[model samples]
Target: MSNNLALNIEKIKKEKSGIDVLADIYFHAVFGEKISPENLERFKWYGIYAQDEQQNYFSIKIPLNMGELNLIQLKTLSLISKQFSDDSLIFSNEQKIEFKNIKIFDLPKIFKLLQEVNLNTFFEAGHTVRRVLTCPVNGIDKTQLIDVEPLANKLNETFIGNKKFENLPNKLQIAISGYEEGCDVQFTPDVSFNAIKDSKEKILFNVKILGNSIGFISPSQVLKTAIAIANIYKDFGERDDVEKSSFEYLVKNLGLIRFYDILNSTINYKIQQSSFKNEISHPRKPRLGINESKIEGQSYIGCKIYDRVVQSSKLDNLSSLLEKYEANRVKLTHKGNIIILDVPTLNAQNLACELEKISFNPFV
Candidate 1:
């Protein structure tokens, strides 16, 4: 695909840009309201990607921060799948919920539905800072001293919908975790932070900027540190070659020292010594089958669907099944799996069976 995006994306905030035109399409579909060719390419802002095989249909991606979804949101998403798309909800490696074969006409309704249920596809895709991923067991993990959810949410709330950060030179993938055992340090596209403690047990974060050397900052500083780096990326990232415009490229071109100088001007970003290290060496652990929750008598079920594809027809059934068993909270994993949280231990087997009935194989 050619990179004509920089010119077109600027219109996203204007009247008829992809996202801005959604309301018009929603209201005028009966009168043949159609997206212009220019807006067609801009639809990714709303997580709507044009299907390669079908021009009129799209594939939708939903952002679930920290891989979480309540019972209501699941019902809304699954129902949209059954009503619109091919009943195929694809689980992305980043833990997002996706539905393919969605009609161009249905984008508005879907967006509206998600808003009603307190869920959204906004900023899930495109050149924006994608979904904020965090430790799945953030609150429940006994080994975790601090909950990364607050910090992750703070970063998300700071950037999403804010015009300064809305249009980035490239997408930024951020991951935060309090647990060092299974963290997403290596794969995060832009930046990552692992919550840690010094010898005095004071909370701080080990920061990885543009995937380079380690740095340190207080728990309250992740927001400022992130903004500074992102601004540097915005001001200097390679926009001409689209392909070379990644954070990695910026780091390679300017070198870490220059990047640090630019970053220091934005916040009191602390650069740790060469010997400082973070302990998160392994990948994120799978929260599958039946795992003990922090609360006794309740467990989180990690069920694997053959691959990440959850058919539209199965979603409604699965949603109902989860609600029936009183396990309404679901979390998607980086491994492309789903975890049913807060299930009663006694109903774990029954829930697993129901999931299998819908072809979401729990045994795997």
Candidate 2:
């Protein structure tokens, strides 16, 4: 299509108010033709983007599962990449796609192409699950006694897909942590499962409910089994009042037994006394090389993320430094801290200095 055609198409799309009408106009403008009713239903999954004169862009929300991006979506994105000004396709920090630097006139063509290619299946925007964050390493941590990834995934699937979870009283945060120094941000989550190892090497998990980042950081031990714990939250979790909703609020008002009873019906396992103890260390003054790792001769450095904002620029620099310094992997801690594992003795001091320059203090 010509540049003028693209521009005019985008103008019409932006002028239209609702997504359905906008999509219809877009399809006609792009193909110089019409779309069948069945085809329109297929296009519902895709989103729209329009750019105004100020270089700002807007996205129409689309809901899709969070997994691997499909081939069709990739192809649509590739088309957008060619049509748009920049190469960068903005994946929002919350994991949604942003079409960058496209003129308002091109929106209809882009939207039509997105529909024809079935790209909507991969695009999800304005969805509430965006508020929930899970560590990729949740169940895979070598130090973890139990894998909580399954439970976390189950919770997300149920919460997002089920109409009941959409009405949640407040945004709920959940984390699964394994290791003496937890990798998952357990402290900040409303509900957290931390894996603990006993003297006999028996691995059991403790469910912490109602833990918050603010002053109300009350850590209560609830269920030992992850499934039971998740079910408990789902059962007692208030959906009517968004303001008063949260696992913490429910547990506080209903008391333990009442909460346990609700979850007990769904969970087959027996509720055992929590053998898990609060083994996590309190935060220390910001410094380098203060916290040692389980691996001998290795230490961790805490980098205060700028305003707790994790950026690609900082991560890119850290990735390069890790390779240069012989660090094995970078672990993001729940407390908004990043850990560089397996630092060699010879490079530890130098690495610390370099990290300090980047606003990260080596554990002292």
Candidate 3:
């Protein structure tokens, strides 16, 4: 493990991409083989981590794309938690679901279960793109300037197993928002795309890297711009010090202009220098309680998971209500609240009461 890469983790990533560890993981999980120290670190790539010093128990984190799940997916997660994870599901602020205290031999079964639901832990913890975050009400928010969910989904899909982004100096996080007031403006991620209107009254995305607004891009250019920035960070980001390895640190050291120049070379279009109207400077209101959706006769119910833990039993109970109300999708907000989407306006109150019965405070 000797190389020019300063951090041991960097060297490991250089030697072997974390995505290639699946076979080894399968073997270890099925045969109960002992994991070597290097592989233990590599396990982070799959969102698997040793839960104890002895490595007898493990924890797994499942990234929810845009924090979204259909009713069937939610039911499957509940079944997994109830049968295997001590009847608990820990919802993270990063909008991931975690199951803790799992025995080693159960890993195979858990992974299989997740696969059935089209979920994976790849890059969930390692020096790769973490789960892409987005506005919870992207498609349904009344005040949204554009629906960034499709772009977010496409951006996430483009990078998931792409080798160019596999071995970065540090983990990367990206958030996309179309909220008129800019939902992710205050949050810090390696990159963010906030929807805004141009002087010509056309919609464009205000691109920020490490909390600084680098420029603007048309919706059609977001994917390419993101790829270019990712490449810049992969090639030039500082690796000598773990503390300085994040893309944020690199942006600060290189300054925006130099970074923008590097970015321009990697993409087809010239980057546009622009400023965003800081709407967040005014008082911000939280999206809570039953609210009207963009679609007529439809409503969305937002409930505060205040403590952010949902028992498996509650999800089991919720499955019935989901079917009863014909609400098929649930969204987890960046603030840790949960929103049940696509509820009929007529059924919103009854559904809210049902959510309250399970300790999901819809009043919030």
Q: What tens digits encode model 2's per-residue C-alpha lDDT throughout 45-94?
A: 23443334232443443332222234345445655655663543443332
Clashes of each: 4, 15, 0
lDDT against the true structure, per candidate, is 0.71, 0.46, 0.80
Weakest 10 consecutive residues, lDDT, candidate 2?
212-221
User: What lDDT tens digits, residue by residue, belong to model 1 across residues 1-364?
Assistant: 2256555454543444344645654554445455555565556666767675336667788877788988888777778877887666778878788888777667777878988988877776656776667876677656676877778889889877566776677777777778544365226446777777889999777777644445678888888878887788888887767678788888879876677677777775455534333343665676567777777888888888676777756777877887788887888777777778788988989988888777776776
Which residues of candidate 1, in runs, are more than 4 Å off? 1-34, 52-54, 181-186, 269-280
**Tens digits of lDDT, candidate 3, 61-89:** 98888888888889889988887889988
> How far out, in Å, is residue 248 in model 1?
1.2
The candidate that wins on TM-score is 3
Give the clashing pairs for model 3.
Answer: none
Give candidate 2 misplaced runs (Cα > 4 Å). 1-170, 179-188, 197-201, 211-238, 273-292, 295-299, 305-316
Rate residue 62 of model 2 by lDDT.
33
- Return the TM-score for each candidate structure: 0.87, 0.49, 0.93
- Clash count, candidate 3: 0
- Using TM-score as the yardstick, the better of models 1 and 3 is 3
